[model samples]
Target: MVREVITYPNPILRKKSKDVEVFDQKLHTLLDDMNDTMKQHGGVGLAAIQIGIDLNVLIINIPLDKEGSEDDGKQLDENLIEAINPVITHKDGELVFTEGCLSIPGFHAEVTRAENIIVEYFDRQGQKQTMEANDFLAIAWQHEMEHLSGHVFIENLSFLKRKKFEKEWKRYLKENSKK
Candidate 1:
C-alpha cells in the first residue's frame, strides 16, 4: 500500500524516530509500503518518518539510468534497499548535492554530505548487513538518515537560503491553498 507522505511543517517530521527492535511481519509490510510510496512519488528514497511512522526505517533505490539519458526510465526491484536501525559506521570526504524530500516537495537545496560512507544496518529479515556507498548513494543515505533524527535538508542550507525558502514556501503554500 502506498501511504500518504506527511509534508513539511508537520510536527511528525520533527520527531525523532525510535529504533526498530523486532524484525517481524509488520516491519516487512512497512518496508513494502515505503517502497510503493517512494515509487509512486518518483522519489529515489524514503524514510518511515515521511509516512508519519516514527521508526528508524528507510528505503532507497538509485535510479538505474541517469536523468536525461537515453535509458532514463530503467529501474530494478533488486536495487531496492531496506535499512532498519541503520548507523553510519564511517564517513569520509565531502560532497555537495542538491537534495529534495517527498515530505518537502517543490523545494531543493544544495547540502554538503559525506562523499563516502560505510553503514551498518539490518535487512528485512533482521540479518545484519553492511554497505559501502559513495556519491549519490551516500548522499541518499545521509539525507534519509537525517530524517530519522528529526532534521530536514533545508536545515543544512545557509541562513540566507533558508530565509528565502521560508518566504517562498509560505507564498507557495498560500497559492496552492487558493486553488
Candidate 2:
C-alpha cells in the first residue's frame, strides 16, 4: 500500500519519531508500505515520519549508478534496505549535493553530508546489521535519518535560502489551494 506522504510545514514532520520496540508483523507491514510509497513518489528513501507514522523506521533504495564512480570503483545492485532504529556510528569526510525530499514537493537545496558512513540498524527480520556506505547511499541514509529526527533538508540551507524556500512553499500552497 502506498501511504500518503506528509508534506513540509506539517507538525508531524517536525516531531521526532519513537523507536520501534517490537519488531512484529505490523512493523513488517509498515516497511512494505514505506517501500511502496517511496517507489510511488520516485524517492530513493523514505522515513516513517513522512507517512504520518512516529516510528524510527526508514527505507532506502539508491540505484547503483547513482553511487558515484569514485566510490571505491564498485557498483551496487538495486536492493531495498529497511532500517529500524538506525544509528550513524561513524562518518568520514563531507560532500555537498543537491537534494530534494518527497515531503517538500518541488524544492531542492544543496545539502552537505558525510561522504561515507557506518550505520547500525535492524533489518526487516529484526536481525542486527551494520553496513558501510559511501557517496549517494551515504547521503540517502543521512537524509532519511534526518527525517526520523524531525528535520527536513531545508534545515541544512542557509538562512536566506531557507527563507526563500519558505516563501516559495507558501506560494505553492496558496496557488494549489485555488484548485
Question: TM-score winner among the candidates?
Answer: 1
Clashing pairs in 2: none
- Each prediction's Cα RMSD? 2.3, 3.6
lDDT of 1 by residue, 1-179 (tens): 99999988889999999999999999999999999999999999999999999999999988775442324645568778899999999999999998889988899889999999999999999899999999999999999999999998999988999999999889988888899
Write down the lDDT of every candidate, Cα atoms only.
0.92, 0.90
Among the numbered candidates, top lDDT falls to: 1
Off by over 4 Å in 1: 65-73
Which tens-of-lDDT digit does each residue in 1-179 have in candidate 2?
99999998999999999989998999999998998898888888899999999999999877545533433433243477899999999999999999999998988899999999999999878899999998888999999999999998899999999999999999999998899
Task: Give the range of the ten consecutive residues with the poorest summed lDDT in model 1.
Answer: 65-74
Relative to the unseen true structure, what is the Cα RMSD of model 1?
2.3
Worst 10 residues of 2 by lDDT: 67-76
